[model samples]
Target: MSKKDSAKATLNDLNGKEWVKATKSWFVVNPKPRSAGQANHPAKYPEELVSRFLRFFTKADAWVLDPFAGVGSTLVAAKELGRNAIGVELNGEYVEIGSRHLEKTKGSGRTYLIMGNAHGTLEHLGEIFKDSIPPFSLLMTSPPYWNMLRKSRGGNDSVQKEREASGFDTYYSDSEEDIGNLDDYAEYIDTIGEIFDRLEPILAKNAYLVIVVQNMRDIDGEMKPIAWDLARRLSKTYALRQEMIWCQDNKRLGCWGYPTTYVSNVHHHHCLILQKR
Candidate 1:
């Protein structure tokens, strides 16, 4: 059933955290600790999002892949729910945290952490699997938004900033490990599309790939429509199914002056879901 068709999602999905929704998105709630972006990476999407995807996309002992594992939220979620998880994180610090969290949380033996870039994973992926890389049942991750300076946006721009300082720039461009340093928007989108296009072969016939992304604010001062465009790009490979809205209740409160009018600060996210044929 569509999110609109169901009664409003109840408080929390088996987990204690309250449900979080974005104004215009689809999917369920996922809550987890923030992964600092500067030292770590900003853990934007909630863990509830991860849990819900796990619930709907895979089953017992299924293999899961998170190409951009950042601090291992997906890995943590996968382990918590009993799925085999393989995570690739660019930052050594994040890999450590993800590793530690999994250890402390009683991770399943199937959980494996790879400290590296998502793109380079192409080479190691085959080796990691050994006897033919098993088709992954589910793939979920949030790609870095453009290399926008997150610190400049904080305090002055947000309702709230989690402990993790990681942002698109911090996660991708700022680090030397980024797959391709294409600053151009179209280039970035195309590169991401290509990455996933290549990823299509490794996924199981009926597997699902879900991405969590929001728009970005540029120096030009206009809202970048990254969300809609990404869907169009990925639609070529995976059947872009729906977008889940992840809204935030807490905020620092601020005003965004309109070039022509007035607008209040906004906080929300889009969780795009895709299923492979």
Candidate 2:
């Protein structure tokens, strides 16, 4: 028998060429323009981004989960790729917008967007699935980047000002239960860790999780390595496979602390890929 005929592709549906291409440690994805309803979400990552990971991580008809579903980007992406998806979102407005978008998504796979905190949402999956919740083969999400959105960058070129002027939300939500609203950084990291740790029961063995996150500069000029911190925290629960850098070349550059101190225009996010043990 020929090697090509005998070799099996187990992780995903990608062929040899596609599999090799996806193995690269970094990728570039500039977000597409958002719709009016989608623009209401302060931190809505693109569906295209989610679609790329979905294609590389899961096969057709595989179940996917997104715990931090903002406007149902992950859910929509999963459906488009013929993968069943379940999303847990906190904000009601975002959930409504996500549901509207999900309705228009045309695909063979089913999708459900539950409006509730991700921390406790998994417990109620039995009520929705009737028999038992399917073990998710892949989990891809970009959770809140701490409370950085609420911190004023103190510049006229700040995107927060433009968002506020355009009547859009500047942060995820004002709810006390929101992870992005937490003030204490250590507690915030711990909470996120706990959330993922709880998913052990629902995740299929060897299921891959791709978390899109980034390091940030605090208002006081302190560098917060959020991406690394999260990787370290989650490593205890899930096997830390590797990190893929998601770079964006389309974002406009801002002179953050120019002429006095060096400040880079960070246009990349860390895609930490982990596997269920």
What lDDT score is found at residue 19 in candidate 2? 92
* Residue-by-residue lDDT tens digits, candidate 1, 174-220: 56556334468898888788878888888987787878777877656
Best by TM-score: 2
* Candidate 2: residue 170 lDDT (0-100): 95
Cα-based lDDT for every prediction: 0.69, 0.89
- Candidate topping lDDT: 2
Angstrom error at residue 102, model 1: 1.1
Q: Compute each candidate's TM-score over C-alphas.
A: 0.78, 0.95
User: How much is 195 displaced in model 2, in angstroms?
Assistant: 0.4
